[model samples]
Target: MKKLLLSLVLLISFLGNSQILDPVKWKTKVVQKSDTEFELVMDATIDDEWHMYSQFTPDGGALPSVFEYKNTKGNYTLVGKTKESPYKKVFNDIFEVDEYYFAKTAQFKQVIKVTNPKLKEVKVYVEYQACKEQCIQQDKTFTFKLPEIKATEKGEEVIKEEPKEEIVPTEIASNDIDSTSIKTEKVTETKATTETNKTEVSNEPVEEEKKGLWSIFVLAFLGGFAALLTPCVFPMIPMTVSFFTKQSKTKAIGIRNAIIYGFSIIVIYLLLGILVSLIFGADALNALSTNVWFNIIFFVLLIVFAASFLGAFEIMLPNKWANKVDSQADRGGLLGIFFMALALAIVSFSCTGPIVGTLLVQAAAGGSQIGPIVGMFGFSLAIALPFALFAAFPGWMNSLPKSGGWLNTVKVSLGFLELALAFKFLSNADLVLQAHWLEREVFLAIWIVIFGAWAVYLFGKITLPHDSPLSHISVGRLFLALLVSIFTVYLIPGLWGAPLKLISGFPPPMTYSESPNGVGYKNQGIVGATATLPEHAHFSEHGIVAFHDYDKGLAYAKEVGKPVLLDFTGYACVNCRKMEQNVWSKPEILPLLKDEFVLISLYVDAKEELPKEEQYVSPETGKEIVTVGNKWSDFQITRYKNNAQPYYIILDDNGKDLTEQVGYTPDVEEYQAWLDKGLKAFKK
Candidate 1:
């Protein structure tokens, strides 16, 4: 079972990066409180596993949602403050404060008295912070068209129902939200989370997508073959094949039952795959990678499985359930064979369940429904094939290796690997949270210790709780021990940043270490790399001198007679991290960025508050620019005409562009070339 999980992780490490998440939607409606009084109703629809902070956060750790009213000045007089729906509160570990937020939906209301009856509509946008694995502050626009209202001097007249103020619902994109662009209808009726707002999943099969799914299928098939080598399932092949031959009256009937039995196992696993999709919602498998709870839960679950496999205790299905399943195999005919397959599934769950779960995780990471289905289909096919083939020819059972002490050796080895695989999840959570608990050096050290101990155990120096007495180690065991020892030695260099490309994804990125250069590395005042730092300039995580404020960085660039690397990034932006790890760390690019450019990294999601005197309302959005992030974010929108993170633009000493801006360039050579071009132009 532990081996199953180990192989599953090995295969899944090849899966691609995570998807971009836009988790909140917004809409609004206008309500006539009386003839001249109107109320604006705005609601936000949040996606699963994500929550948005309330307008008035009680403890004030997270950025609270704020609203901006546009084009409603002289025509209407302000009523009371905006009232929010009831929200839930929870303590945040990062900020050490309780935060108020809403899951699924959050509603807010604002009432206004129309001094001039000509007020026809209302426009507002909400800026809020939403968090799941990482926090993101984004905006959504809501345009509410007002209905025609008539007021008479005689008395407060009851509004006529014939021409009610109903609004045709519409979704406004963040960048495209303005007064003149959005098309809206004036009716009182309003709707939210409607069909227009639903994010559609394309079931259309692309060639590359199918190829990726097929790769998962093939890898899962190989994993299935590996699972058959485990003690739990390997010994059962002979027992089950013999039972089929004895029960059937004729040889052909036995073969038929065996084939049917094999398919039943496949069906069982396919159901597991389908369950993964259904449980996570229709097709949320794609978005599961960045989920914080999922990583934490998986880490703990795999550790428990590893402990069980290490002979600490047996993790087993309920005895009563197993007994009932075994009893069903006693029934005669086709039903009995199907039950026999079920019996095997129940009995060997300790072995197969972990592998199946690991495979599903791998498939789910692929972000395709077909990957899970086909991957499981391939996995169960591997498990079932040997049973059917051996039943058809009982003589083949003699060729199978007899289960022995070697099986225990394999199990213990896998338990060690299970420990290794478990940390990958924990590391993922740590990276997501920037908790710094398991940096690259710490992680590599842990793996070296784990693999080293396993090698020592394989040499017969240490016997586990279940190991049989052995006078001497087998040649096979000695050879594997040597291999493990060499692999352990190979990992030692990774502590000092050897890239360790062989085990890349298993550990955190090279930059996410104790020393950005390497373990125990220090700058001996390298001329271009290290110098007297200017104001607001500090060594960034990438080991390059960086400034958070744009003006300071630009001034320094002018003084140094170098260009500027304007990085509009966010702390939680996954793409930005990817670029830093894969592109900036390149031998060709890192030095150029360090020496040739004064790098300014303006974090669009930074949580620190700006100076009180510097804060004001944004002229464009009318939202308050309170935080450092808010200032940088508005600056990016106004200056660069872009709000997306991981945005890079090379500028001359005057802070003018030297090259075209790019976002998320994955190709290292292309990015390096871009930097080279920018440098050449600056020099010219």
Candidate 2:
């Protein structure tokens, strides 16, 4: 009775697991479109709450749905690229990409021309993933027979159709499937490759670039709010509104003119954005963010802006241009109001210049053509709000605080922020050059000093060139000083190798630090114990003791009698850094990675030239593998059929998979379990 009860429990558990594994039913149909052409329709009837990804997923994103036609002979020719039904596009925080997925039902169609009409059937396979709480990859194949047509006595073809085959849903355990069998060769050539032959498909998800425009606009709006608090622009606000209110024929007229003036400000800034887009072109401007010299120049520019903000000097346009615009402003008309707004823009150049330059730089770096226009629209909206509001309610002017030493304080504080931001651009330049000058500790040290000086300035111990006499510090000033002091203190621990999660992206990364362990000497330092590793072993600046060469890592793993943990990562991969900081930082995962597995991280973006003897043409991509990155990129695409970053694969010394691969999973406990499973498999 006990044995029978245990058997029943085991059966129930296996059945439950199988139901969770499979969540979608797939069906295929051949729709007759023309005499020679036919549409191969692949439909997925997904289970409740489960979703499938689209085929047009971008690079550095989730795995896209792929179809492989096992075309051995030239019987049928592909018409064009496959088309998918409309899917919802959402920003996935885990993957950090705008991914497209479909729920309920999805239909993908591929048009193909039947060159050999006598051909009876063709075989095609598909690989896709479905997700709900967790994602599960699926591979399935189908064979479709050609429809038979008979000639009639009336000279019309009589078509005879066979009953469609019913598809039954099947659940397969993820670990039970072989990885090699699932990987398929990507189809390239099609008959409808020309522009005229392209099919009109409207159901595709919206482009990911368009989604980021809203974020850029929000950032620009916040920047405008910051600029409004500056000395040069803040005082001008009430003064400009007052001029319009007093000079207008009536209250309504005054409000109307003020709104027009606000709109003029928006138009002027937007034109500047358009001019920048025209000059640099969107692509080149975006490329500037990663360019070494451009980043260096931007770093210097920000420092100069910071100096000007600190009251060292002023940045202004020619006096003649301001005078001419001011003259035009004196005319009593709508045109005069525009000139008046333009005059204010020129007059406030000393303060607004740095803010505008920063906004434009960020927008340009975003790599979208409309980014600058959208950003400037948001910025101008924030700046224009107060002018229209004050003119509409003239009595509100009495509540406005009188600008004095407080304005100078604001300017000086901004100077410190600009100085801190300059270091980020400098760090970017250093990272691209692979120069270790501005490492984690050094970057934190600089920020600490800058903020510390800011705190002193707030407390009236230090002053800039344009400061008024400080008889005593106000309560607000004292509070600000205390906050700054605390922030400065907080940064000090970061120099000793704290994660400093708040400012994670600002620094050059902890891995690039001079000392990976901490500021002072440590027992298990990344560099100190490197001599223990075998010859030809390369260590990252973080001192993980890895090998850049694949063969060397596998050989070492075999020597150590351990499995290989292949980490496919990149230098510029943001999510890779995040995983290292958040997930890999866990005590359980860190030791397993450092001690047990042979860690082999292949950088898919490495630019180092390969040896002449090693360089060759990639059979898969048909591109020359001239660099280290190219070789590994081809290897990943050909072997595993994946090219995404932060990809982890646990393999035995013989290069067979010990466990299924995963990408950018942040759940530490789950990842630890995965590692344990791999280790267990290796032991077996």
Candidate 3:
């Protein structure tokens, strides 16, 4: 009898741990509005607390609902894009975009024109994601028979409808009708279907194209300042101004000509910006920021630039091009001034080319149509300012310091900075690909070594190919050396696991580290206070006692009589790391996360393949689930209708919500309050 009772208890536990929750229901129907025109409606009856995303979610947001007509060649033509019922629009913090979703119920409709009289039925394959406490991917194929129409005496088609009392399997409320019934209602465009009648318009202004102009200009201006410190451009300042002072007929003419030269420089760079924009288009350039191949290319390009800056070799324009442009400058007029500007550009190419390339790449990544133009404008303004100002005040030339080895120091320092920055692009690629080779500790170590070498070089302990022999380190050099040495020391603690909040975005996240559990630097504020747990307690990658599987988490929560804190997260989520480091590390919040609630961190992007027996076809999306990520991603969508990471929900052991769902809230006090509220609700 005792053995039987123990076996029964074990069986119940296994069943509870194996339960998988799916929370969405769908129905489809075809409604005849006119004889030739019929509306195909897809209705979703979502479970309570769950929601469905609309088909119009913006780019960089959650996947939108989609409907694909399977067999439309013979009998029907798709009239317009899918139209959806009213949905709630809210700003999603995780993706930093406005997203639309529907709770409880959602209806999508597509108008179809019957092309052949012999048409019998219409078939549609629908795909959507639903979310509440979790998400699930769902797909369904719906078939609806076309209603028969009879020809009258005059050959006009009339509806042969059933009686109103007859029960229809797929009937919708009359008041819940499609807005397409109104003549003025516009159909919402859907990416899933194409409309043949829609006219393509060009030269239209777009919102994304207008963004980041000012930011690009500022960054370009800073790039120009850095260029001004380079060897090729610095010596030219006094020489060019002196020529205007000595060669011109009068001071006024020299000033005027110098201003014209400045304008010419702006025009030249602006034309270059325009050419680049024309070549690639703003959308494609913006997308390059996230493209792995583009990032790898950028990494290699930057490394080459760093090598050049370190005096490995000079990256120069063809001498023939400069000579040709210089020859044009001998004409001696406005055209000559423009050609002179071109000559300056060609001559300074070795020094400024890399800076210009970096600036343009960064600006283009911002996804603004005017980014290149604004960046060029700012860069030109900086290069042009010295020429215009010094030409106006010829006497100021005496105040300038003579150029020497210090300029080389500037170049070498920039090389170090470039080398450091180059790794960031590499790290971005590594993180996106889930290649843990450049983990946080490894990245920090590399940075420390690079900066330490740079500090030694600053103090004249080391020298590059172009560096002059140092008699002694100057006071300024000493100060810079000290600063770099201190910075290198600061980064050392990060290897053992320090938050290093100052350079948080540069390195791979702390969670993606060799010691993610804070093994060595336990005293660091980021390390969570260890808690005693039952022998069966499972922990996350970060060493926090948490469950990676949902059913196991809920079962544990039930056993412990504690509420579950469902953390919908991703491995690559940046804000999620910020929250963990800044807010969750706080005294007020850490205890609750560690002790008060049962933390269940579901990594939506986990790529580990599930066991073959554990994998199954997703009912919602009709895709084979082969990995742990797919299962959790599907769960989040099906339960909560949200696809963004860092989503949090507090639920009782019964899997009911104890508090409202929150996402990526970084404020410590607010998060603590939220946790306290959930705890109170749990107790009640």
Per-residue lDDT of model 2, residues 75-152, tens digit only: 888986676665655655433344566777777777777777787666777777666544444455666655543322
The true-versus-predicted C-alpha distance at residue 84 of model 1, in Å, is: 24
Return the TM-score for each candidate structure.
0.66, 0.63, 0.66
lDDT score for residue 111 of model 2 = 76
Model 3 Cα shift for residue 632 (angstroms): 5.7
Candidate 3 ranges beyond 4 A from true positions: 1-212, 517-537, 541-543, 551-684
Task: Give the worst 10-residue stretch by lDDT in candidate 2.
Answer: 175-184
* TM-score (C-alpha) between model 1 and the true structure: 0.66
- TM-score of candidate 2 versus the correct structure, residues matched by position: 0.63
lDDT of each candidate versus the true structure: 0.72, 0.72, 0.71
Please give, for residues 431-453, the per-residue lDDT of candidate 1 as tens digits: 66778899888988999999999
lDDT of 3 by residue, 1-684 (tens): 954764464345334323344455555555565666777766666778776776655333445687888678877889867776555545444343445567666777788988887776677766666655334444556666565644323312222344455434443322112111111111232221213111111222323233346657887898888788889999988878877777689878998998998899889999988887887674465455556677788788888888999999999999999999999988988998899889999999998998888777766655445677789999989988887788778788889778889888988888888788888778767765767888888889899999999999998989899888789988988999999999999999887767777776578755567777554643443344454554445655334578877888899999889999998886545466667767886778777787788888888767699999999976755566778987887777667655566778899998998766777676676677678878989999
